[model samples]
Target: MADLTTTLCGIRMANPLVLASGVLGTTRAILTRAARAGAGAVTMKSISLEPRDGHPNPTILTFEAGVINAVGYSNPGVEEALAEFADLGDVPSPVIASVVGRNAEEFARVAERMARLPVAAIELPLSCPHTPGYGTLAGQSTPEATREITRAVRAVTAKPIFVKVSPNAQALGEIAAAAEQAGASAITAVNSMGPGMVINIEARRPVLAFKMGGVTGAALRPVALRCVYDIYRTVRIPVIGTGGVATGRHAIEMLMAGATAVGVGSAVAGGGVEVFARIAAEMAEWMDRNGVARVEELIGAAHR
Candidate 1:
């Protein structure tokens, strides 16, 4: 079998497949289950300073195009999350604590708290489309805002910082480059795209509770690939390419597009946690069949 191990910013992964934030990542049991299921790592759902119930019912919709959701970044707050993290003792895979904040100082506070956990690194969800006054607002508004958040978080933690940026950004490359300049250790390119809407023709209403949600799954693969390609060229840090990865081929494509790791979210919604091992198996099989010796050989291969 082809070797699947890869390293990002000094942390080593058994494979490149990471169970992306969201999608069954809310609790410690589920997160640990994913790691036990063969995920090289798992990112917890975004946590904030206070608990949030998020939007009402019908926050998610699934159709032929893909899954669209406005889950509103619901979470039990950082203190509760810290408790959850503390309960998960000796999980086999690395855990990346995903943090969301309304401002730079809040981001720093959360980062400091998460740094006390057993996590391997911290990930900042800078581009969540459904949540207002956070995520994309703090991320895509300006490169300066992105830089400030990154700097503050970096200052508080010795753990590697991974800033997840949005594909909806006006200056995607500039924002990514700014995060790099501000001391980010890695970049997770392209969160869900758009407050794209779907309507209930009979009810004459929006399908989602929020009226709009971020599009995910296969439909987002192309856009995410392009975002990773652009950010990869703009920044030297490792990139976690994520958006619509559903299969092994898609993971390979992301790596070829310059991802040091691949984040699988929507696919898990379909295949459950086993998607992590499945994707890894598929990637290794493909590499062996293609005469490739290891997964790292494919990283940025398409850039040429």
Candidate 2:
């Protein structure tokens, strides 16, 4: 069997397949199932300082190739998350706690609370572009503010921290370098794009209750790949590649382009949990068939 194992920021994942934060990863049961199903690791649903019920009405919808969502970062509060995390047993694999906060204090506080848990990593959900203050901080169009928030979160936890960025920003290289300097162990580029909106022609009204939603799927692959490729060269930290990964071949492409690992979110919504297992198993088989003895060998192997 091919060695599908890969290490990111010092954490060794069973495989590169990861369950990205959102509806599928919100609970321990779901996370445990993902782990069992063969995800190398799982990122918890985005948790915030205070509980948010999120925008009402239709928040999720099927777009042509992937999905458009404006879930509005709804989640149980950190206190409650900590409570739920305490009950997990037989955790199938490493866990990444996804946390979001309004400002530095919330980030620090959430990081500290999660530090007490058994999580292998912490993913700062700084992406939801449609939200007000909280969403933009991670991909803060400005490097200074991004650096400030990263610095604050860094001080509190020694666990590996991955800063998930929004694609809306114009300067990816600058901001990625800033995040690395501010103490992020790794960078996950690029989060969903657009505050793209859809309308119900019949109602002559907007579809989502939030009106605007982030765009994700195959359409985002090029943008995400470019961000990872650029950031990989600009910074010494690892890059968790994402955006439109729906097949084993897509996973290999991201790996070759310098992603130490890749995140699978939107595809799971369409492909189902079996998709996780399929990707891992298929990747392993592809590695062997392609004469790749190890997946790590593919990292940064892109010729141009």
Candidate 3:
């Protein structure tokens, strides 16, 4: 077997495959199941300071291309999350808590609460396109504000922090650098793009209840790869590459683009959690064919 183990911001992973911040990240059982299935690490769904109902139904729409969603950061507030966090130590794989907030104080408060848990790290989704006041408004609105939020979180936690940014933001490189300067240990690039919509031709109206939602799937790969590659050059910390990874080949591309770990999301809606094992196996096969002895050796190979 190939040595598939990798590290992100000092947290060791059995393999580079991470169950992205959404998907089956809600409860302890589902998260542990994903780990047993093959995920090296699991990121809990983005949580907030208070419980949110999220947007109405039809928040997600499926099409031939991929998935468009405006789930609106639905999560059971930090206080309620304590129950789930209690089971963290028993999980087979390391758990990373993903958090979102309306302002710097809220972001800090959430991180402070999560810091009490045994989480490997805290990820800030600073750039979610569909969410109005939380991610998009705080991140893309200004790099300085994003920096401040990160700084606030940094002030409260000794655990590693990862900042996940959106592609819709301007000066992505600068925004990433700002987070790093504010004490982020790593960066996850390119959250879904566009609050795009599909119209019901007969109904002559939008399909999704939210009207527009972030686009995720095969269409986002190239754009996300570029974002990771650019951020890799801008910051010294590791980058967690996520966008439309559906195969081991996609994972390899992210590593070459300087991602320390690759995130698996939308693919789950198709291949199920087994997609993690499939991708890992595919990656090993590719390595064998290329005579690559270690997975880490492939990181940033494209740049060299």
Error (Å) of candidate 1 at residue 79 is: 1.1
Question: Taking the tens digit of each residue's C-alpha lDDT, what string does model 2 give over 219-255?
Answer: 7888888888888899989889988898898999898
Cα lDDT tens digits for candidate 1, 24-74: 789888888998898888899989988889989798888786789999988
Task: Report the number of clashing residue pairs per model.
Answer: 0, 0, 0
Q: Model 2: clashing residue pairs?
A: none
**lDDT (C-alpha, whole model) for all candidates:** 0.88, 0.83, 0.88
* Error of model 2, residue 14, in angstroms: 0.7
Question: TM per model?
Answer: 0.97, 0.96, 0.98
Error of 3 at 150 (Å): 0.7
* Tens-digit lDDT track of model 3 for 189-210: 8688887899999999998888
The model with the greater TM-score, 2 or 3, is: 3
- What TM-score number comes out for model 1? 0.97
Where in model 2 is the C-alpha error above 4 Å? 137-139
lDDT of 3: 0.88
